[model samples]
Target: MPSQIHTTEAGFELTEDQNCMSELVKLCTDRPELVLFSRPRDYYWEDVSAGEFLAEVYALAKGLVANGVEPGDRVALLSNTRYEWQLVDFAIWAAGAVTVPIYPSSSPHQIEWILEDSGATFAFVEDAHNFADLRAFLLREDGTPPLSGSASRLRRVAVFNEGGIDEVTREGEGVEQSLIDARVAAITHADIASIVYTSGTTGRPKGVALSHGNWMYQTRALVTNPIGAVARPGKRVVTFLPLAHVLQRAVAVALTIHGATQAHWADTSTIALELQRAKPHVVLGVPRVFEKVRNAAYNKAADGSGVGKRVFLEAERAAIAYSKALDKEEGPSFALRMAHRVYDRLVYRKLRDAVGGVAQYGITGGSAMSPELSHFFRGLGLPVYEGYGLTETAAAACVNHKGGQRIGTVGRPVNSYEVRTNDNGEIEFRGPGVFGFYWNNPEATAEAKHDGWFNTGDLGEVDSDGYVRITGRKKDLIVTAGGKNVSPGPLEEIIRQDPLISNALVVGDGKPFVGLLVTLDADELSRWKEARGIPASTSLEELAHNADLRAEVQDTVNLANATVSHAEAIKKFRILNRDLSEQDDEMTPTLKVKRNVVFRRFADDIEALYSR
Candidate 1:
């Protein structure tokens, strides 16, 4: 038997005295004038220098100290991804407190649970509306306000829209700067930096406790390594992903360390407009964002004239072929090169221009992207690097980056992480980036970790070259009544590539045959209805049963079926009226489906596939 373990040496390490706050402090001292961040104004963006940001952070830290916040206290931040979020986060750290982030979209029950679980006392929210909602939920039955240091220990709630930063700034003015300095000096690499909760795909969310050394080590390695070359001083980055996500937060920390000019964009609906305006050098997104961009381009091409559509189809084929050819010993042929060059001008250029026209490349995670789609993007002179990691790994343990890229695989271990496969083929990792434990959940932590290695629960394979290819979730395996096991991830990835399909959830555990539940893309469906001359007023529920829509979905299912064995193939499918959404509690903040939730919510629908 061959060895299953793959290990990469550590690229960087942290000093004993260094903490997450050290880099910002160093930047302010070394390059006070460097523009560290830019926040959007009414029309243009206003830049903030390193010195200015540090000053504000200190002032906020003083305020935190004045507000009865003690060292090691957990301060909860509930808001969207914006400048204030970063401000409060650093302020909490500077005050020698731990930051606990709650998703802005979280429900009242979730907010209560997280606050109670994390033992947070001070909270910052985004606006008046959110504050009002929070107040309403946390009020006592006797009508007393919860802000009086109630049962949950949450004493105060500040709203950004209500001049919360200014209020805090004013409160700390009388406080001495030496107090802030002393607290900063007291913090070390061993102290906890933040407690980020998991997405809670199954069961309740567990808080992943990451120490300052974990971040300092991981971020230093990221910048010093070849993969993070783009994170140098003066590089512009537009951060739109929620900071509550460990991946986005880690990237933000990495960028801040290198003096990159960061811009915060919270509204996903206007992300394209923001991206175009920022013209960032590197982009970071989830697989869904990239998928939407690809689907949009495909839909546009299809909606054009017949000649144009044919040209696009031919261009796509040429792009994928050219990308694949680059991997071979002999490069792309002269004919293919010529064809690619032509398409680069005709089709690829427009796609690139759609995303700011300046993005060198993109980094995507959260889910696996099909090899075909990855190739198509690379063929357009824009490679989308895919990384694989969990909340436990602090973002990326394996990544396909600049010089070390492999198209289909998430590249070798990063940040000195070691990867291995057990006899059952489940992925395991040990690295500086990995969190030490789950906050107040020792049982869960014990279950997830063995010795120094973290059990990832994800199944994968490691090639001779050390590249890691994720096969599927070990817990998500669907075993049929006949005992044939199938992984739904690959089939779902293929089916979702269809322009009209937004999501595909495969079902058939202990069933006779595989079945599927699919949801249509709202934007694509509207265009499809228009192109086919369907009534504009038709609702999704009405269209779900349409013969034309069903036939189109069946075609995608057929394509998926062709890739797998007969036992694993999807024999039937049902199109849902609406897309799976976070609001419905069917999806996590990271856009991963809550399988148990979906199974319960649509039990009848799932059973209907087999019953008929």
Candidate 2:
């Protein structure tokens, strides 16, 4: 039997004086002129050097200090991923304050809960909309304080669109820079850096307390690990994933530590344009982003001339084949190599050009990625590495890296991390990246971490080669009437690959058979309808019952069914008239479906599958 436990040696030990702030300070001191970040300005990128960024950070830190922010104070930052998000984060640290990031998409109730829970004193909102939401909780329409004590500790709210950064900087003009330095120097590895709340795929979100040491450790681990090969200095990466996401936050730290130039782009709608403009060496995204990229390419080719479509199909097969061959002792044959080279120019080059001609590879997480999609990307000469971790672990506990690539697995434990499967098959982790406790939630903390190990609530297996393959959520396992246990994640991942399907949820718990509820991708459906000669303005309700549409979905379902046993296979499926969205509270900010929320909201739809 394969060993259940997998461990990786620590890349480097942290010094007592080192923290996330110190890392930045060291860079500014050592190489002040080094370009650290690029901010988009009218059509081009404006570079911000280390010294410039540090100076701004200090100015803001002084502003924060002059405004009564004290060491250990929790300051709230409500915004999307942008240059200012990073700016406010470091400035908070420089003032010896803990950051509490609230998603810009968060509801007023959610925002109030986080603010009250974290007891944040000051806050920064990105724009008028965000400010209005925060204002709703802070004051009544009459401009008086709200009745409740929720977030009462919050003293002031700053709006970025209203020149919040400039206001804060100006307020600190009289404060000495030495005070900011002293505050930064006072912070240590054990001091709490941020209280990150979980995305709450299930119930209420809990705040995970991450220390400065946790982030510093990850900064070192990322640059020293195999990933650092391309993530090192001079490389450029675009930051688009919400900074509230721990994965993006940690990656930002790593990029800063390694001197990589980062560009901030909050809007993903123009990701293609941003990618082309940044021309980054590395691209980072969630699984859905990669899925969209692949689907878009395929759909574009399918929509083109028949010859182009055929060439794309051939290129795709060749790529998957070439990737699989690389895994074997005997690599791709001469004929296959020749075919790949030809297709590289004809098909793959365009795919590469779509995401900037310079991208070397991509990193994806936040959910499981189908091996088929991973192999397809790898075949395109742009391998997309997948990693596994949660906000509790500060992003990635284990990640697939260059030269150590594994398609199905999330890869071995990262430096200084130990991963193992308990008797119940739940993945457990212990490492520098792991958090010590949840903010003011000792009971939840005790339940999650025992001795030194953090039970991830996710089930998985560690193969003999030490690769970690996630199976499913331990809490999400479904058992049929026949007592056959099924993990829906793998099947759902496959079903979601079809361009027309936006989301799939598998359900069979205590039922006689498994069933699926699927939502359609609106854009894909529009394109699909156009290609099939359907009316452009066809209503979703009408299309839901369309024979051709049903048949196409059935084909997708059949493909998924073929991959599993009859008991675990989806026996019935229904296409929803609408797609899921974050606004409906059916999806998280990271695009993960809220299973319980979906179950409740779609109870009628789910029941219809069984009643029939």
Candidate 3:
């Protein structure tokens, strides 16, 4: 049963109850056009505030309502990251309907599957990209089959980036704009919010039904957490992670309710420039970002043909010593301070300059981050506090409180959440923020909950101080024929610390020992080119077979292997140059590697690894 709702207005001026969806709407009512969101300079500024935004959205909701968009209707949003996508979602909620968000790059089959599964009465497409895909899937006049059982339930279609009064028709069956516009109206807590489908690497995608109360409830853990204060009312942040993911959405809109300054929405390319321009007090990043930054620093040092790299390392050592001395309550000795000053002026300053003066703390999430990356950032005097959570929990259940961050763990549960480890070490959560259930999938929902506790699906343990250390997924656990249990996520994380390695999936389940199949991050390798005089045209596949490169990777793998017992060490590894892309079913929309996909694709490689 759903718990009674409560809200708190302690630190925020918003609401006292966690389920105050109306208060969130009231923010829109009060400031209709206070610059709620803007696209990157690459895109145009809608310059909408809460009030005007809500007014227009409510008008659109009314439009949908008039078009027969009845309450509880599921509306699908298959669009790219943009303000309009949020608007459509907001409109869906405003109209007292459920929203189903699809990745902008979702294949035609997925589009139809979600539409059919959620019984979406309406859908908003971003542009020609998804619009074309949906068209191809739904209407193949040349005797081709529809992607998902004809999606007979779909009654209306809307474009997020454009406005039109005309309805679309096929075979004389028409869906009119007027019909969609009629069903939308003001939404309330009793209204369903969204039906978000999981990527479902293990099986079929399950629609995770989130309610207005669910979004509102999960937000408490984030808006009330210690780390949630990273960007206070006045702080600025830049977001690049896809808004389709709840993590990024919470940081953008949910945090807005907390009063944050939005500078710009960055293009996928100019994130570096965006950071420099925004000087964001808070940032969200994936492991790839950190790896790129680390590689750039190393390459710059290595660019002088080895001697320069050594000098850079020496300078870094000096800088760390200096930073430590400065942070010490007691002043450093004159001699040490003098050495530190020299290093600070030379190495550390340049490194900081590279990624923009992101001297303050930022966040790293989406997938597992290497502990070395965490320690490396700390060494540079930039705090990259790790956080762990899922969309179901609304972005953050545990985050390293800004004032007290652990180097490796994903910090403690936020003020609003309680985290405990089950007997199998899987993290279980009970919080105001936990989502209710998967949309219409009682079996999946049952599996995800135990009493009131939400199953995190991740196997982890808490340190004595309570920081969460994720080891692996319960599903990813490998029990050798000899009954030696191995959690691959830890080893995989350690392997990914190597700048050249973007992703590593360990396979050994039902086998004797572990083997690794890896992906080379081409960008980092391009940076490493100068040291070995490698040409720009060198392909990742070619690089994979390069003996010299293989030796370098082996050395990295060996170092990672040393941290664990011999039985758990990766017995063999093969470099895979083929990038695992979201389009190819290799990654979640948030860019987390799909472990099942990796294993299946590399079955031949795994067999080869064990052949000897």
Give the C-alpha miss distance for residue 88 in model 3, angstroms. Answer: 2.1
Q: What number of backbone clashes does candidate 1 have, counting pairs of residues 3 or more apart or in separate chains?
A: 0
Instruction: Determine which window of 10 residues in candidate 2 has minimal summed lDDT.
Output: 136-145
After superposition, candidate 1 runs with Cα above 4 Å error? 1-3, 136-151, 225-227
Name the TM-score of candidate 3. 0.85
lDDT (CA) per prediction? 0.86, 0.88, 0.68
Tens digits of per-residue lDDT for model 3, 1-612: 322222222222223333333544656556544455545444543444556666556556666666677788877787666656666666666566777888776666677778778987667786666666666444344534455457446655666545531232121134344433343324444456777777656677778766665576556556655436643445666667777777777666665565455544525667777677667766677767776777677766776567777877676555545545544688567886666567657676776776567547667777777765665566566767778888777667777756667656788776566777877667887765677787768887898898888888888777666678787888878998678888888887778877677778888888888888888777677776755789988887777778988898899889879988999888888887576888788887767777877788878877887898
Off by over 4 Å in 2: 1-3, 42-44, 139-145, 149-151
Ordered by lDDT, highest first, the candidates read 2, 1, 3
Best by TM-score: 2
What's each prediction's TM-score? 0.96, 0.97, 0.85
lDDT of 3 at 574: 86
Task: Please write out the lDDT profile of model 1 over residues 42-87, one tens digit for every residue.
Answer: 7888999999999999999999899889999999998999999998
lDDT of 3: 0.68
In angstroms, the error of model 1 at 325 is 0.8
Candidate 3 regions off by >4 Å? 1-21, 28-34, 40-46, 136-148, 161-190, 226-233, 263-267, 304-308, 311-343, 350-359, 527-530, 533-545
For residue 482, what is the lDDT in candidate 2? Answer: 90
